[model samples]
Target: MIAERLSLQLPHTKVDPRILSALVCGSALALLALKWTRQRRLQQKLEEARRKREHALMEMRTMSLQFKEQNPSVQLEAILSLPLTELVEKLREGSLSPESVLYTYMGKALEVTHEVNCLTDFLPECVAQLQDLKKQKQRGPLYSVPISIKEHYDYKGHNSSCGLAYFLGTLAQEDSVVVQVLKKQGAIPFVKTNVPQSMFNFDCSNPIFGQTLNPHNHKKTPGGSSGGEGALIGGGGAILGFGSDIAGSIRVPSSFCGICGIKPTEGRLSLCGISSPVYGIKSVHPAIGPMARDVDSLALCMKALLCDHMFHLDPTVPPIPFRDEVYCSTEPLRIGYYDTDGFTLLPPCMKRAVQETKKLLEKAGHTLIPFNPLRMEYVVGELFLKGLFPEGASALLEKFEGDLIDPNLKPQLSVYKLPQLLKRILAFFLRPVVPRIAGELKALCGIGSAKNLWKQHAAAEVYCQEFIAEWKKLRLDVVLCPVMGPAFNLGYLGKLVASGTYTVLYNILNFPAGVVPVTNVTEKDEEELRHYKGHYNDHWDKLIKKAAAGGVGLPVGVQCVALPWQEELCLRFMKEVETLTREKSRSTIGPRIEAL
Candidate 1:
């Protein structure tokens, strides 16, 4: 019976070689032509957008020159030197005209962008907006203050390209809720800054707008997707700007740029009209916040933005206004401090930033308690990496289909784009060699079923509860920790994304977090970094160690975190850190402080 069955097997069918060759060649040629067409189309879109931006900038420059020529008495240097508070005070008192301030910042922005390439579009409509503001009898909180916004915020008549060629010509029909509030508060949205492609990568670069160089060191990234705002603000082009954060988009850039920024609890501020590639990922909700040169500026921005206008425009946001009392309170409270998240070890500069911040806070009479982040490796994998792309990275990968990939986003994208089964097999084999990478690989495979996605979200909630229980057990008012860097080399994050573990923890917990610059990388810090090794003796760790070199004099900052809905308290902590850093800088007691 076996012999009969074997004998019954059909012979394999064969095709003519000539026909097969023709089919293969035809398919290959068609694919090449398709790819070439896409590239050409992308270039056309990119060139058109660049031309529009260039035209806008030229108009702005002409207006700026006319303003300077018209207002011969206006002191551009003095006006630019003023902080947000003083600037607003001058504007309110009629000492500084809105146009003068606007033109001053526009000129400064032009100068800064020449070096850093941080700006996307110069809003010439700001001149018209200034006229509108002049008609208002009463001054608003941010009256006549020029502000730059991250490019993804929807502004009527402008494209929120988000550094992608596909979105280059798609204009917003109306202003974002936040932009509406800014206009209502008398702030001039003079220019929009650049962002990473899809606004996902931490290193700011995209094919259309190019890369934003750090104002401090050209070789280092300014941090993204708020990197343009960071570079602009840090370079003193704009006093206060707005940037959104999911996983350190705001705070990391602020930290790297030696500035201040806050990521309020999700839903605390309106996110309506923000263009997002990950529009509906509820597992890790992105928050909109202010990035400024100082904590006070951030507070002022928050105060102005969290108004009835924002609440009315986006009812999904919590209606609670900014709490002045919480921000101004002088209460001495318990604070938790940690240098390492345990998943990825910080470079010496980052560790020193946290250590020095702890000492300064303790000296200021705030009680400091030691707190260790629990299961951070697990949180990073299951809660963050998995939660972000629960349906799998296919959707995100698709966003980059026809666009040129930023170098910094390519490594992670390559891994995420791998076949699900192949990823799992790779993860299993690398478990012993690079446990963290393996875990991330496994998590990135994603839960293919709805039931599994639900379970994963459930696991995230449980983890947050456990983490909060620990916080409650300690009775901590705030947690002080290192923000991710001393501005790594421009393309560093592409190789080692786990560096984001520091900030992703708070995002997972949905806690309010702020970053305040405390110190500059010291020579001693660089020496210590030479011997640095991460938890794994793997490629990622080696890359991190290599990227941390030559970081001396770069700005370092620490993060201050508070419980959900405690943005006011978080800002208060940031202010305290800023205050202490200033005093310490004056006395030269610790590592060199670089205060904004």
Candidate 2:
């Protein structure tokens, strides 16, 4: 009976400790195996993403080759060889029809887009617009003129993605104020160009569209976030393009791609209806302007956009029409120039451009005064960044969650991830030791509160006052400086902000600035770069080294800046520079070419 009871009880009893442990281990293994299978599936998905990117790149290259084959005459020099004023004059006098000009540009643009990846949105309606202009027998300054817009600006029935994938199908319900103005002036908007994700980085790359290459040299980047517009204009596909600059967006690409661009003062042109990730934060100002192959075209576009109706559309703008009197006069003016910012040493090509420009201005009887920037390091490093993203740019970056961040913007996001409290603690601790650098650090760490935001605004006002004071003391009308180092090779702009030293200062001051191509790369310029000694000992040094290493034969450009609301004066300076450069080239080539 005991044996029988033991057998029955054993059947009902729980397993021994080792057996129970074995069963639990088996179940856990099964779960882990299932998880491993899921993880493998995820890995496959990632591989598929990479394959898609590669396929897109290949398709783009193939299309570029086809474009080149179809239009062999569309060379970089060919695009920049003629002035836009002359082109427009010919079109007006019946030498070129609207359709002919539009087709030429469209063909070229189609070709360039394949190679450079410049277009994010293109409209077939442009063809119809040109056709209507041809039919109506009407013409204007930009009539039938093909213009490309950066993706940030709104156009009715188009996606103003601003290069963000999340906003992919979100089409605009109506045109931005500027877009309507451009249309009313008879400009045909053909293409919308690519930008950096969120328009935050100097390099242009986003999940929505890839990268744009410098037209002069494909190995180098066309600078951003207006990089696509810059490349399109530079490549001769479009006569004019529109770009916005809060920090070096217009100027950097203009410099890198060997084109002319203008950044007007804040509120000069209407910003109403423009789309951006960081909307509603107006602490730092972004002005819209024109980019083109020549300065005259830039001036013309500016005049057309700033007509009377535009000011009425946006009440915030001052009722300042294009001041033709300031631009048309040929009076000698006081110009200020500085070779280096006392922080990062400029590349040698840039130094030569400035030096050569000074010689030309002096010969023309203009007063060339040497002016050092008023504490640029303190301003850009400290104040500008602090005020730019007051609420810490979290919203802008969060939109890209799970997407691969551009290598150039990775460091920026890391800085953004730290707690605001820690950043403030660091700022307080370091304020007494190195106030300017500390301020810069605090800004980078996004430590500003409501009180801090107000303080930064006040600081900006003081800086602006100081800048005006210095200008008054020197009695200067315009300032000249290198836009950046020799155009950085494509794909390597992730390392430094030194290139922005020239343009960002103007942006911070809300001054009008323009870029004029002065010279192309030469053997001598390349040799000088081989032995460059940069002033700043940081990532700037590394950036300089990379730019110098293989950046031979690229174009170099310089900035010409005028006081706030002085767009007309800025164009005048640009014209002077252009004239001087052409005359010098002619003089040098005269005897050699004649003998040949």
Candidate 3:
């Protein structure tokens, strides 16, 4: 007040206007200089982080290669070639030593890591732990069995960076709940795999760890946010690996990489200590589960995790043990299936993959009924997208406050960066011109207010209940549907952002969904897809067709969905699909795993 009064009073005796102008200009320049210095300092810190990350990465990569090089032709085949189920059985029967299993998988995983940049942290501590476990007289189910983990699983002393440069330096003080359960059951977690920056995008890439590519074909993405685990398991390096799914993080990778993944309903497996960007926002809670080469492997890993040990570790998880009866049931089921998700149309390969599976299920004596895709425009546009960013994406954006952004996240950020006024204008104008992209952009804008966010939350529950009621009305036991497919070529995610509607729907519904590979993309499927127009013939369909082009021999997969908490039944259905796929392939009845 005194300063204001003095300035106003002194206005009658003002200094030279030129001098005042110069002073004002000087102040502005100083502020700019201050900002410039802060940015420079930030750049220096980032440079230091880069050097440290590069050094550690090179050392780890070299060490991984050395493990491969040091492997003698002795017993690595027995270690690497056996499926996870067989590996565990053999280990239980004393067919393999703990050290040998660790060494063999370590060597093979390192080889895959070198090719795909998958493993985020190679834990030598795993070896020490294994050696210690070897002395125990009593063994657990996963005794001497090697398992891989998604990078988000915290292991004491290692950072769960999840591809973010900012999270690179902070070390975890304790193991995550999943890690504890795995260790208690005697599973050796030797390596943690890479994920997208912030674990948000479907393509796994970051400045710290780079991108993870498909092991089957290096030209295509492995699918993410669990891309590293998908790459590891798909490449035949890890027997069973753990990953988390919000949308299709686990299943998309499984579909893309020709593996199996299970997304148990929320609270089935504990997420305690698991690193996630959207940790507490639970409208679509991220569920942690297992990914593997086959359905049995998935079940085995799930059984190990969904035990009393897990409940003890995190009391939040319901004390529900794995249900053997549901998994072991042999009775035929009534299944509902669809080729397209209604939001994003399936390409020919994807449609064919589902069609083939539907036929196989029918032939296997399971009744198959056509299920229309539900209200995906609202499910995706209003419920899921709004639910995720209901707070206008502040939680999601805070991680990038001063960090280097990944190219994979660039397109998503564009939507997040748009002004509310601009979004409204675009929404109105694009509603008729390009409704699909408009809805997507509008969804990405996030819910602007708490009232709107609450509506979205209530809307999600209502939608889930409505979906369940529909399922009951139709008497559908399980749903077999096309997963978003063809293992997209790298750099196409920006255009194909909506391609994941197939997987995201289940997340919103909180369904227990598992993915299984049905067939590889054939020349015919690819050719047909090139000229393909989807059911709706919308903009998304056109974009999908473009993305699916040249995807020949890339794997196509179908998602097996059951009601929430029905993971065991979901796995059982996935097993049936796997069994029927094998039988059909043997009889030359339909699409084979290898199109060639």
Per-candidate local distance difference test: 0.88, 0.77, 0.83
**Residue 183, model 2, lDDT:** 76
To one decimal, what is the Cα RMSD in angstroms of model 1 from the true structure?
A: 4.7
Task: Name the top TM-score candidate.
Answer: 1
How many pairs of residues collide in each model? 0, 4, 0
Which stretches of model 2 miss by more than 4 angstroms?
1-82, 135-138, 419-440
Could you tell me the TM-score of candidate 1?
0.94
Whichever of 1 and 2 has more TM-score, that candidate is 1
All candidates: CA RMSD in angstroms? Answer: 4.7, 6.8, 3.0
Indicate the worst ten consecutive residues by lDDT in candidate 1.
587-596
- Over the stretch 1-596, how does candidate 3's per-residue lDDT look in tens digits? 96579788896766788988999999999999988887676577656655754565565556546655775544777678888778888888886766667767767877897798887777767767887788888788888788889988899988787776567678899999889989999998878888988988888888777889999889888989999999999998888898989989999999999999999999999888898776667578678889998999888888888888889889999998889999999999999988876667777888888898888888879999889867888877888778788766777888887777888788788788788779878988998977877887788777777787778888888888888988999999999888887788787775566788888888888899999998998989877876777765777677677666778888888999999889999999999999999887787854454575
* Per-residue accuracy of model 2 over 1-596 as CA lDDT, tens digit each: 96578779797765589977998999999999988886665456445533644454354344446655665664534433457777677667876666555556666776787788787766656766766777765576677677888988888887776766556567789989988878777888877888987888788877556777778777778888899998888887788899999888998889888888989998888888878877654446788889998888888888888787688777788988888898898999999998888766777888898998899989989999999888877777556676676666677777765455666667667667767777678778977764543565566765347787777778888888998999999999999887875667655565565556677788788999988888887888778777776774445565676765566777778889999889999999998998898899899899899999
What CA RMSD would candidate 2 show? 6.8
- Model 1 has an lDDT value of 0.88
**lDDT ranking, high to low:** 1, 3, 2
Poorly placed runs, candidate 3 (over 4 Å)? 1-73, 535-539, 589-596
